[model samples]
Target: MSATASTQRPRLGVTFWLLAVALVALYAILVPILAALYGVSVPVAFLLGAGMCAAPLLALWYPRSSVAVFTVAAFVLPLTVSPDRDPVWPWPWSVPALILFALFVLTLTMQHGWRLGSLALLLGLMGSLAAPLLLPDAASAGAAGADLIVTASIATVAFVVGVLLAGRIRLGAELTREREHAEFERSRRELVEERTRIARELHDVVAHSMSLIQVQASTARFRAPGLPDEAIAEFDSIAATARSSLTEMRRILGVLRTEDHTAELAPQRGIDDIPALVDSTRRAGAPVDLTHEVEGEISAAVQIAVYRIVQESLSNAVRHAPGSSIGVSVTTAGDDVQVVVRNTPVPPSDPGTPGHGLRGMTERATLLGGEIHADRDGDGWTVSARIPRQPAATEVSATASTSTSTTTTTTTTTTEGSA
Candidate 1:
């Protein structure tokens, strides 16, 4: 139970005890007074009254024991009336018995649900009807057959009503819970549909534009007559870069277009592609100094995360801090790979604003059970990431490794010449 519900229990207990005490006091006074009027002994009347109150008193503390307690009280009540009386039944106690019966039904239903409460109600009705047979004065008593029938009928009606009401209450609560859950699921599905729609729109616009740029750049290199070799080379480089971006964009769009999460497509770029990334940044007019001291082969997932972090950091620097010298480093310490990218601060004309790139980098690192930190470092900005490296299940081929190494060397030489 919640704290508020737990605290209310004591208050409820106090209220029940107070109500039980008041009812017992009323019974104690009334029964003895009526017996005195009938010429019965004061002691016997008070004792019987006390006995009558015992079940309800026990019910105040042990509410679950109510059925057993009421059964005993029902059997004992009839024995209290005088044999010489015209009406041998103790009809005055009938009101108290009805009150106790109602209390038992309500408490049992609330605590144990309808099934047990209905059982207790059935037992209570039977016990009440059988009470007359336990009377010490039964041999001289007047017929109570009509009275018994009326009382039993009334109790049965009340029990049916109580059961129906309890069933309705439980059904309503269950429906409310199911409705809330369905609403949550509906909202979640709508959110996913909205995301898919946005992704498709972005793919249509950006991918088409990039593809057109690549085609135009390639066409310009061959179509233009007497063009300088340098200009043709620059155009070729632009086409290559655009083609690379289109490939990456398609990979991302493929993920967005499909609902099947386990669907696989082309392989992704990773750490081996970082040299090309740096070369592209250099071609875009930002000088980058690259360094690495990694020892063992890292998983493709970790390599991809590291490469993306570096790529985004460099892209941000080029956009917001043009003409700034950037430094990139990757080093491994035991089982962890560390990446640091730092660039000179942007001029006053290119003031920084928080964007999605930083958040994406952070999310990537966190997904790999790692962390990234980006902050202003004196006159520059620095991004640092630490990713735990897991071993790959299989080793990459020697041919692929040699090709990547040669590409890295050529890219480094080109970056040095441009610098």
Candidate 2:
């Protein structure tokens, strides 16, 4: 245990012992006063007071006999201790003490537990009050009654304060536990979601790489017997493709390991890179028809959105319906760019392939304040994406058109001079 806790144990023990001694002392002093006021003989009064003190000691040593002894003495002692030589209707000054004793006994019965040194202290107190009533003197019972009332009132107030404080402590502990549990659950959920997102990213990046590797390896194996030189070239291509894929995969994985993600992500590919995307698809043995109308500069965010939409749509088509003829279109009208990718469905050969391509495409578009629609059109699936464009930075188009006209006039003049 820490030094503080170790120190607290002895302090608490000392406090309990001090309280016990105080209770015994208070009872011992009060009993003699009460007995003298009621004119009891010194010896008898002392004996009676001593018995009251001994009751709690008995209760401390013997738990079973303790409560019974305390209860019976509480009720019988007051009646036995009359105030006057000739007993009268008004009982004695000891009545109030008896009442206090009964209430203390009731508390004992209700608050019973393994160790209650505090309650034992209170019992000794009640026992002390019983001494005066057993005396043979004539005394005013009203004053004694007032003292008992005051003592009981103070105890009741203390009990209320204690209960309120305890309730507050218990409530605070419960809230702390609940908050900790919530934090734990939140962390667990985030871990699961991060793993799932990484899996998706890995599939998208590595699948393309693996496909290239597979094609090259197959070509090398098939050409080995017929063309030795070409087969070696194919093996080299396979190794290069695998290495490229490995590099790209590392770059993608690194994005997930940091708090600042801007450094980890590659520059976004966009509509301008559509030619490259088409070339890749064509190399993969898919027919791609391209339609381009947007010529103006576009925002990086919008371009990225456009690129992702097309990328996901084409990826889905290639995986779900290979060898399908795809038509890709891009058009910009004022402040908006629209993309459409449609592919004719291929004949089903492979089984158990489900469609998540459309969902991925939709997720990309929706994240960028754009919308994508993928639906069946006759014998094909068509995906259309519309993204809002950013405003132009400058009127570079006007300057370019004016320069082109000047060049045309100059060319005409030169032609006339040659003639």
Candidate 3:
């Protein structure tokens, strides 16, 4: 229970006490009147009158209208049979009781707050005690004045205490509701954040790898006629790469809630992975032609970009025009790697086909500060990407050797061909 309930408990105790006092007071006032009118003894009259207070208690325990109604009834009962009742007009003790009952009834019906009915009932007690004083009889005035001061003061204190207690109860209930709401919002926010993180990781992983695979597959198809066994080996490598990429992607997303604190898994495909990508698509039935002009070892970031551009274009060819031939070219010029992929026009294909090939490629190229274009070029669809590369040892070797001795170049090409 809240503070309101705790405080209200004492008020309840006081109300009951006041009720007892009212019964006794009315009984004391009635004994003389009953004895004079009906010749009954004081003891009998008092005993009989005291028994009437129980009616109000019963009503209260049963809770008919409001506790105040029963309480007022208890106070009013003695006024009805008082032998001092004047024929012209009775001592208006019943008026205060009625007023108390009305106030309680209103409070019960409206129930706006704690003040109205409880205070009204307390004031009624005061009014009842003061009634005889206003009659101008010295003895009656003195007795009524003393009685009113004592009883009203006690009842008023009880009413005020009850209101304070009730207010506390209301405050506690409001706080509890607010606490629950805050907790719910916190849980919901955590769920949203978790989902967003998963999405970002997925986008980073799948798009990059898929683009590399597509480009390598295109290269393998183009070089297959010139070199068969070597190209076939590349195809096998491409399959393994694809499967590995798929596996890593799944693992990253799987252990989201568990924190093992491992270093982030390195992305499986970089720029160098393009050869395997082209090889895979060639084996998958889309004939891809690839040519590369690079100085030497391209930077990993630049390699990844070139890989994605060729990959997306080739993947688009396979998806949008399944049997179409694709052409891929990569030129690493100083600070940039330019890659272009063009495929035969797709015959009227189904518009509803769902393929992530294009989206994956686009996401990859964009991440590396590169751009891709897919449009109609004469009789086929063409995709192109330009990526910036950092100068490295492999870049110098790849570029310088392309222009030098034929034997060294052929041997070098053959070696790259074998790989």
Best by TM-score: 2
lDDT-better candidate, 2 vs 3:
2
How does each model score on lDDT? 0.62, 0.53, 0.51
**Model 2 lowest lDDT segment of ten:** 410-419
Model 3, range 330-417, lDDT digits (tens) per residue? 6666666787788776675544234344554555455455667766788787777765455343332221222211110111111122
Best by lDDT: 1
Compute the lDDT of residue 403 as modeled in candidate 2.
14
Candidate 3: deviation at residue 333, Å? 7.5
Candidates ranked, most accurate by lDDT first: 1, 2, 3
Q: How many residue pairs clash per model?
A: 0, 2, 24
Candidate 3 Cα misplacement greater than 4 A, ranges: 1-268, 291-313, 329-340, 350-378, 383-419
TM per model?
Answer: 0.44, 0.53, 0.39
Candidate 3 at 243: error in angstroms?
18
Residue-wise lDDT of candidate 2 within 99-185, one digit each (tens)?
Answer: 334333333332233134246436544654564455425335665556556655554554444445446656876899899999999
